[model samples]
Target: MKLGELLAIIRRDELDDESQPYLWSNAALIEYAEDAENEACRRASLLRDATTPAICRITLVAGTSEYDLDPRVIRLRRVRLTGNSTPLVPVTTAQLDEEHPGWEDETGEPSCYLTDWETGEIRVVPTPTAVGTLELQVVRLPLVALNDMEDTPEIHARFHRDLRHWIVKRAFSVLDSERQDKDRAKDAESRFALAFGDPLSARTEEWNARNLPSTHRDGSE
Candidate 1:
């Protein structure tokens, strides 16, 4: 169903008392907003305290049918600080060659090797010679409440539209950041080229021409 309808159902179920015109008074709304903001901060702080570093994953899940009910499906992901450094020990290229003998030479760089001592799984590790210490950040939606929004048709519709917009925008932001990061790791001059393939290359001419302008407009110049 549409998000608006879902939100409306939540509202109606939660707040069925028509007598109260302002189901959520202005003070209550303000308090709710504050509570949400505070909850986000509090959860973030708790993560910081629990985790060794100041980085932790945040997941948001919005209930569609019942707030008390388990989510129809749970989505999970992680988040980490931008500058947090992780360890990268060195391994011999010759050792990697001995392990993955079938791996053809794709990029002529010296292959790095890694061996899972326990599993005996040997694999060639991509070497970030220039870029030392990399960290993978995960972003996720944890929990969301659609309570009482579905009851009122107008409020439900608005909530759905707004919620979808919020989700899309947030998701896009995370993807955009990740793309930029991968481009940076590759030491590429342009994120657009890194993300959509080389624009100047003859093979990718069609895709380049189609997306280059939009990519530039998207601030990937």
Candidate 2:
């Protein structure tokens, strides 16, 4: 759904005419809806991994084993060394140090990788014998935002109901309507579960039962 339409609905149904220009303005609703969309993106893993680089080069410094990854990357799904189809073995810093005490002394195609998530850096043991590409699969944050009436959400239209419910819940909370906030929050949770499927299912059949896909009323899905 277009962001403007979603914000308009929140303003009409949740904020209403009485609170229109005072308690919540058009800009405020747009901001709140964006926040809700971000939260939903994370919760449902809706943000695609398409932004991940096809290859991150590993610099072959004579003495250094570490290289920077793209800052936009949220987390690495898997990484491969040059010419290898399978993902490289992953190792923790502690394990790398323990197993390869003289990692600097070695030089070869990286067989194992260690990552510093906080720094967005990767340490390859044996430093590359030659500079090579680090083929990777990664998750990234969504770039879309709403700044005006024409702006649209990056979220799939299938999840629009959940997004609307989420905005309604946030609207109630911001307005200090405790009872309505709790009620709308519950409604939002239900829509979210329906959109993303139940997380607690162990059996395939049971999981499929709760994983039914939602259809859009606009016939877009």
Candidate 3:
């Protein structure tokens, strides 16, 4: 299947959990993942066009509370085109520390650090004891495609590492967007309350704005 088709399946399969609040209640998280996946597919297509290996990097900003809830959450995975099939690979802590040394703790787990990419840099630190956020980045490299196709453990291992980076980065984007949306909501609520002197009404309006249908409320004749 094409990359886009594969992504559709991945999103549907991996993100189909209805019990997760991030997946069910947060549209931003869902949309963020879709966009990240689409970007990865697009990059993959470009690599295919150039006949060169491509690397995609995705980074996520997750709250400390979220991370504490599930430290081992496998946030990202990817599938790449192989000889006759697509293989899925999970991103892991070991790979991240390899690409960016000293980024993880001595135990081979992720640790807060200052990450700099071509576009920008950010200082990542755990949030308060109960509340923290994670930052994720995905990088794509085009130079390794040919070697990745080789039938050897080394090739598979490298591909797996690359796939993990891409997937984690994509997952991070989902978390970051959700945090932004919450911040935006809070800001909007604050502004409305200041303007109207009625926090309850402002909250109600915000909820209505988010969920109400676009059509006229009266169902006009």
Per-model tally of clashing residue pairs: 24, 0, 27
Q: Is candidate 1 or candidate 3 better by lDDT?
A: 3
Question: How displaced is residue 48 in candidate 3, in Å?
Answer: 14
Highest lDDT scorer: 2
Writing each residue's lDDT as its tens digit, candidate 1 over 131-176 gives: 2221212121123342342222122222223222222222223344
Models 1 onward score TM values of 0.19, 0.67, 0.18
Off by over 4 Å in 2: 17-22, 50-64, 175-221
| Error in Å for residue 5 of model 1 | 2.2
Model 2 steric clash pairs: none
TM-score of 1: 0.19
Q: After superposition, how far is residue 1 of candidate 3 from its true place, in Å?
A: 3.6
lDDT of 3 by residue, 34-101 (tens): 34333333333212221212222222333321122111111112222222122222223455467756
Off by over 4 Å in 3: 17-165, 173-221
Worst 10 residues of 3 by lDDT: 65-74
lDDT winner between 2 and 3, please give it.
2
Model 2 root-mean-square deviation: 9.3
